[model samples]
Structures are given as structure tokens and as C-alpha cells.
Target: MKKNALLDAAEALLSEQGTQALTLTAVADRAGVSKGGLLYHFPTKEALVKGLVARVIEEFDALVAEHEDGAPGSYSRAYVEATFEILTGEARAHRRWSAIMAAATDPELAAPLNEAMTRWHGRAPDEDPDPVTGVIVRLAAEGLWEVLSHTPELYGTARLDALKQRLLALTRG
Candidate 1:
């Protein structure tokens, strides 16, 4: 719980104040813990970043599991629904993803994210019966991620939610 609090503090700091204010001291302060305590959990800034990445992956995996269990056996539909939640800011790290992306400088720091992406995409069917719709849905979801990661301010949550609904509809069709 303390670890999660520290990671949450780090995400809030980075999202609200940008990377410049995400020092260990600042995170400890925001989390209302001692610097030493924070260090006890995350010995370094890189470690904190890794923890944040892992948290994101863990949250994403849970959401995917939720969708998978709901649909029972449709990978494409579950993947699309999960992607929609992510793009629509319904997912936990939707707003704070930039924080993790910014801190993912080192190879080790980036491995978890890269591995998650690879595994998630691997679950996407390589050859769908309706290739056109699948391609469209996949590209649209990827495009939303690019836009969300680069400049999310251009689209408010409502707009993103609307877009997600349309994208999910496409996936269904």
C-alpha cells in the first residue's frame, strides 16, 4: 500500500507538474512520506519509473481480463474494448501515461512497456475474416494512442469517449 501510494504520488506529480517536479523529495512530500521511506521502497528514480510502468501494465492486464471474461472467447472484441477504454480515459493510467513515457529513457526502464505492447498486440489476430474492418479498428486505436500520448489536451474526455464508442462499434461490425 505504501508502495502504491508512492507510485500514485509520483504519477500525480508528473501529470500535474511535469517531469521537472518529480524529484524523490517531491514525490515523498506529495505522498506524505519521508524521503528515506520513499527510497526504502524505490531506491532510485528509475526504480520508481519501473514501478509506475508495472502498475500500468498490471492495471491494463486486469482490464483486459475483465473484457476477456465478459466476452468468454473473442480476442478481437476484448482487445478492441480494452483499447477503447484506454483511448477513452476510462483506464487508470490514461491521463498519467505521459509520465511513464517521459521517464522511460533507459532500456531496462522501457522493457516492461515494450513487452506488454508486444504481448497485447500478439493477442490481436493476425488474419481476420474481415481484414478491412480489423485494419481500420486497429489503426484507429493506435492513432488514438499516438494522439493521446503526444497531446491529449486537444481532445477532452467527452470527445475521447465519443470516439471510443464509434471505434468499438466499428470493431463490432
Candidate 2:
């Protein structure tokens, strides 16, 4: 739909040009829609940003769900699987990084993302009986995500796979 197009345009602008270039006018132009059309979907830049954040969170949740099984530590395992996928997938990497940067710059914009993460992390303790191990695995996965976001070349594919496999193994225990 047109709303998705506008969101895609906004994400493209954010990823390609950075935050300063992500105005409503720029997004409207990029989507090949008129200003009124853009306004019909998203009235303000903040609303657009929230839409982007929500989309990313929804996509990530679906990815995690795909990895989930009816077992202990499933959420932790899914988190690791989903995080690794995002880190390695090119388009996903760009979209995720753009959303993260936008959220980092504005506290109000960060609320949705922060809340989603809090909900996920809260489930970790309940999903994995061994709370400490779950926390450790989650932290390790998150730490790698943060590091790679800055310096993607920090680890080669083989090493990254090894790390991912190790984390997944921990989830079984």
C-alpha cells in the first residue's frame, strides 16, 4: 500500500542519507508521492519514525518467532537466531541500523523500541528456567550486535558462525 511505500522511502532516506536528510518533504519526494499523500499516511516526521520502528520490531519479532520451538530457552534461542540473521542480512542490517540510529538520537522516538526490548528481555527470565544462562546468552548476543553495528568487519563469517552456534548450544542447556 501507499503507507508501506512511504515507510520504505523514509527508511531508504534514513539509511542512505542519514537522519538530517529524513524530512517529510524528502520522504514524500523519495516515494514519488505528493506532500498530501505522505501526510495522509504520516502527518509528522516523528510519526513516520515511529512507523519505521514499529515495522522493524514487527519484522524482528516474526524472525524470532520463526526460530521458536515449544521448549525451554526457546525465546533465548530465537533471539540469538534472529539477531544473527539481522546482523548478516544486508537489507535487514541497513534497516535495523537506521532505526537504531533514529531511536538513539531522540528519547521520545526511542520509547517504542525500548519498550519492545524490555518486553523481550522480560520474557527471557521466564522462558529459560536457568535465568542466569539465559541472561548471559542474551547479553552476549546483544553485545555482538552492538559491536558489529559499528565495525561489521570485526568478525569474519566463520568466526561469527562459531559464536552463533556456541550461543545456540548454550540455549539447549
Candidate 3:
């Protein structure tokens, strides 16, 4: 819980000011914890970044699982729905993820994120969908991510929600 609190603080700071404004001291200050207490949980900034990456991967995994456990066509449908949520400000947690992704140009942060993505994507599929279709859909989603990560107003939540619905319909067809 303490760790999550710290991550939450870090995410807010990162979103507001980017990696330049992030520091263990700042996280401690924002989280209302002592520097020593913060250090006790994460001995270094690198550790905290690693924890943040893990938190992102875990959250994404949870979202995937929630959709995967239900009815047919859930994977593609959930992917679109969950992504719409992320891009539409329905899931504010993505701001932190965008920050982390931006920070990842620095090796200290990038490595863990790379590893996490690798593991997540490398996982075996139960019944893999068409590879080409999957790739195209994922690329479209990536395009949406690019838009969301850069200009928050690039697309409104309603438009994105409708777009996702259309894409999911197409994917189902």
C-alpha cells in the first residue's frame, strides 16, 4: 500500500512535470512520507521506476484478464474497449504510463518497460486470432496511443468510444 501510494505520487509528478521533476525527495514530499521511509521501500530512483513499470504491467494484465474471462469475441472487443477507456481519460492511470514511456528513452527506465512488454506480448495465446488482423488492429490502437500521449484533445472521448465500437464491429466481422 505504501509502495502504491509512492507510485501514485510519482505518477502525478511525472504527469505534471515530466521526468525532470521526479526525484525520490519529491515523491516523498508529494506522498507525505519521509525520505527515509520512501528509501526504505525503494532504495533508489531506479527501483521506483522499476516499480512503476511493474505497476503498469500489472494494471494492463488485470484489464486484459477482466475481458478475457467473459463471453466470445471478448479479447478483441475488450482490447478496443479498454483502450478506449485509456485514451478517453476514463482511465487516468495512463497519464503515468505515458510519462513512464516518455522517460524510457533513458536506459534506467527503458529496460524494465521493455522487459515487461516483452513478457506480456510473448505470452502464449489460447487461440490466436488472425495475425494480420491482430497486427493491423494493434497498430491502429498504437496510433490512438500516440494521439492520446501527445495531444489530449486529439480526439474526444465520445468519438473514440464510437470509433472503438466501429472497429470492434469490423474486427468481429
Top-TM-score candidate index: 2
Off by over 4 Å in 1: 69-73, 86-96, 124-128, 149-153, 156-158
Q: Local distance difference test, per candidate?
A: 0.71, 0.85, 0.69
- For model 2, the superposed segments whose C-alpha errors exceed 4 Å read 124-126
**CA error at residue 157 for candidate 1, angstroms:** 5.5
| Candidate 1 similarity to native, TM-score | 0.77
What is the per-residue lDDT of model 2 for residues 9-73, given as tens digits with 9 covering 90 to 100? 88888877888989999999999989999999899888888888998899889999999996998
Evaluated at residue 3, the lDDT of candidate 2 is 79
Tens digits of per-residue lDDT for model 3 on 1-173?
Answer: 38888888888888778877789999999999999999999998888887887777677667677777454445656666656656665545355465465458678677766776566445434333554564456557757776677577766667877778776775553
**What would you estimate as the lDDT of candidate 1?**
0.71
Greater-lDDT candidate between 2 and 3: 2
Candidate 3: stretches off by over 4 Å: 69-73, 89-93, 96-99, 102-108, 119-130
Residue-wise C-alpha lDDT for candidate 1, range 1-173, written one tens digit per residue:
38988987887777677878778999999999889999999999988888888877787687677876433224555666776676665433343374456456678877888888788666545444455676677667767776666676778778877876786666554
Worst 10 residues of 3 by lDDT: 120-129
Report model 2's TM-score to 2 decimal places. 0.85
Give the local distance difference test score of model 2.
0.85
